[model samples]
Target: MNIKKYILSFFLLISLSLFSQEVAEKRDAPKPEIKISYLDSIKKTFVRDDLASCVDSLWLKELTDLDLYNNLSQDIQTINFDEQVDYELPTEVLKARLQEMDEKSPFHIEYNPGLENIIKSFLKNRKRAFERLMAISEYYFPLFEEALDKQNVPLEIKYLAVVESALNPKAVSRVGATGLWQFMYQTGKQYGLKIDSYVDERSDPLKASEAAAQYMKNMYAIFGDWDLVLASYNSGPGNVAKAIRRSGGQQNYWNIRKNLPKETQGYVPAFLATMYIYEYHKEHGIKPERAPIKHFATDTVMIKKQISFKQISDLIDIPIAQLQILNPSFKLNIVPSYKDQAHYLRLPQDKMAVFTSNESKIYAYVDREANLREKPFQIVRPIVPQDSINTLQRLAQAKVRYYRVKRGDNLTTIAQKYDVAIEDLKKWNNIKGNKVAYGKNLRINGTDVEQKLSAVAKVEVDKKAVIKDSLGSKMDSFYVVQKGDNLSAIAKKFNISVADLQEWNKLTNNNIQLGASLQIAKNSIKEDVVAAPERKDIQYVVQKGDNLGNIAKKFGVSLDDLKQWNNLTTNSIALGSTLIVAKNEIAIVTNKAPVASFKKKEEYSAPATEYYVKKGDSLYSISKKYPGVTISDLKKWNNIKDEELKPGMKLKING
Candidate 1:
């Protein structure tokens, strides 16, 4: 080697090593010293080993919606490992590999035809899937290892999770076993994993790993044999004991394997096969698929208030699918707060500050639209004043009180109940038509007759208001025209035809105005209006190709509204089961979705500047913040493609 060239090469390697160890400090100033091109070079040269050694695998560059929504269930990536073994491999090669693995492990090392068959089947048929799982294992293995170390279980047991779940945290078996460790509901509870309406801790990575480790520790004490322990984990200890007894008290797994359950007979072999493939993938020329994100990139925070995954995703600009991947325990995409139960979220470490800083704002977004459910999985904002006295409807003499617009509420019915004219109901709330928005507060009895009423008039007004309040609940299936609502849009919302809407309302034209109530159901305007219509529960049976979203759409209700009405904590509804869609068509009206707010405009002297994304900042929002910047420019400058925006992400903005 040339002396001068070799010395320069050595210095370059040292510089890269030093850069990797240094913590990346976020730039708060107007300009960033690290240019995009320079960062790209560092990424290529270092292969991200500088950031953290725990996650140095090649990253899957495209974080598309498909990848975001991909779980073990979708492609049956986990099932391949669970299926019965029926293939053969060269006996010598299989025995040699098994001996090496078994010698390192505390488990029995003997190889049978069963283990060879599984290893052959997995390598032949499930090579691609197993490779991808190995990639995913980069993030989970660290967590499993930590749990195993704490529990004093052998590190080799970490391969058990890979066999059980293919490293998918959200994996659920047909037998109702859940999570990476594949714990049954009863076993999960016994192991201290929480299972409830709002959260299922079995799918939580950190907690589930700990529970699995503890369970493994306990099982080893019972069986005293690793192979038998693996078999017991698949079926149950009782069955394993029965198998041993049937085999005439044989202590060896292979000796008792013939007497075990059909599934359990193959379980231990399958686990050993997984261990073999994971250990020897390099020799087989199987390349692990690139991981989407690393282990160290994520951090957690205990949520202070109840919030939905959609709400957080909207505010932080992360996709809901990614949120589910990070926090699988939230049963309904809702991180609920029940007493002292701790529910939290795991997000990208960079976005941790973004979430913590805007925790109040995110909760406020939910609070403002708590009852104004507009659409499923969409952020809805209700137009409400600060409830200030100045914003209150100013009536001359009549006292003002807000009445929540319920299902079947129309101006005509409200007027009759309040003993006021239809025009008066519209005039008090600054309405353009005779319709009232559901879930919006209406200022009733705002019409003033006299400046100062005598005791007799006041008493009459009081009596009439009392009667109106009593008759508040109506059975009319009415929908109020909201801002930007056209006849066709309104029809779509109610799952009715545009012609049907026009015919029902007896409209001469397709034109509609805000606050104009239109009767939706055919019998909403019956000839004889009864005092209290019997509120029959409208139940919908789960059908094929039905989900909570589409079912909600079929009933013309928001997804959140559907979940709330049924007290459903998750989207997993069973087929052929009846769900309470609505009660008398009473509480299932949709509202308007809100547009996100814009950021403050700051003057920039530099032609190019670095912008750190904040909560609720979208590409469009960023474009608007900078005068000359456009969405196209932002995407091009930052190489953002199919992936959605995430908080605390750095963007290069050009003016």
Candidate 2:
């Protein structure tokens, strides 16, 4: 009798354990409230909108009270459909199901499941979500397939994003894993997704997909098991490894799943269900509302120049949403340079012509607005290892290919010292014949290697140059220190090495103390002064949604320069007040060439040109004006942005 009683107790405990898990899942869900009136409203709208119509049939009776009760009993800890059993479920039954789904499914979870709505009125709410998912599938599937294939990853893993973000690019988890793939900043950074003051490339569909593929591939290589690979993705590899250790070295994910984190345990199930939903959506009465994917035939446009999203939007008729969708890497709505200082601009097949024709015009817009800031573009030279003494020596001996324009250095003297073509230097730096900045660094040898080598040599020279220059201008110097100035960012703006900045300021502490004025000598005035109330050494309040870029931009400065000026470690800026900015002065570029008209075509005069102006133009138009101009001749002569042209525009003849 004792043994039997013990056995019974053990079974009872097992039952209770199962019951608890079920109860936990169900506690958050309630019976959806159904209204017959709401159902009728949906029916009317569906017919009006010419969407799928709902016809009430005897099929409503198919799910009897006994069936619901039985289902409820099986999952007793779940919603109590058994207790609510009745002959005819009032319309509330439908409402209850919708409500239960809204809460129980991903729709109401912290992870975004698209726009939220209480769709219990009819099957339409769930139907709409399914349809939207299908439409998005067209765009995402191809990209996911390509990335996953390249990484030799399982195609099924692409469905993981559906579970994580439901295809929402802006989805943010409770724990702050953001973007379509829902990667936390640290994790995304680990996988090489750049998050910066200007952009978070992890949110980009193409980039994030590639990152996800690579991450999954790495996880697979680590565990050699797909299930474990998934577990690692959910809870991280460390957690999975821990679970395996706890499970006495079980290699299989399922064997160690019980030992895994609770959230991770649910993760696999959720992923599987999502996959099923994605693949067999039609079986679940879901139809895709296809939002046609806008096709773009784009090429890489190297923007050694800085540009803004607003500028692009204004230039092209493409909506901001479309551009943002195309390039999710831009964090502050500004695209930074890719490794080559280039960015891929995805333009639609038709709009490419318009973009190409107006390329320079768009750039001019950015240039004028961009330079309005008091801070200039900080040229951040990649660091060289000091241990490479031989490399540094060679670089030093390579005849310093860059000349830092001094108060006395002229183009002729600079050209003679470097033994370079003055025209080449001017052309390389986009100088319009004779104009140059006093403190600008100009390239002597336009070769890439020479430029790289010269920058290294200048590291030592730049430091000395800054100190000597500072000391030489001592009579013109004044030190005014404000809040939040850092050495590195400041040095970049001034075109001085950080070491030189420290040496010149005698900053023994290596910290720029607030309210302390550091010395600035003559020739320190790289920019003109703009009048504003002095900072008064007061704390600045950060305003709402104020990021580093916005704050810097608001003060007419560059982000890196701001960090340097303020001595910041991170670019985090919160809303509601102040930051130390150059209120007393503004950097102004007075020597850049006024906007010129090398690319814009103001006139077109040929039968073929009509098509260029109105609808279409081939390369033949150039020959009509200049004669003996082949299609290649025209391509070479006009510097036409793209191969295509709209009707109207003077076709210059190529020689």
- Measured against the true structure, the TM-scores of the candidates, in listed sequence, are 0.49, 0.41
Question: How many clashes (backbone N, Cα, C below 3 Å) per candidate?
Answer: 3, 41
Residue 149's lDDT in candidate 2: 94
lDDT of 2 by residue, 227-341 (tens): 7888888889999999999999988755686798876765665555455456545545677755444223333454646677776766554566666655666767676654433
**Cα lDDT computed for each candidate against the true fold:** 0.65, 0.54
- Candidate 1 accuracy as lDDT: 0.65
Error of model 1, residue 515, in angstroms = 12
Q: Which ten residues in a row have the lowest lDDT in candidate 2?
A: 586-595
> 526 in model 1: Cα distance from truth in Å?
27
Model 2 bad stretches (over 4 Å) = 1-127, 294-300, 337-340, 371-655
Best lDDT goes to which candidate? 1
What is the model-wide C-alpha lDDT for candidate 2? 0.54
Task: For model 2, state the Cα shift of residue 242 in Å.
Answer: 2.3
User: Model 1, 335-440: lDDT tens per residue?
Assistant: 9865546777898775666677666666666776575665322112112111111111111111444566677988888788767888877876889976777656
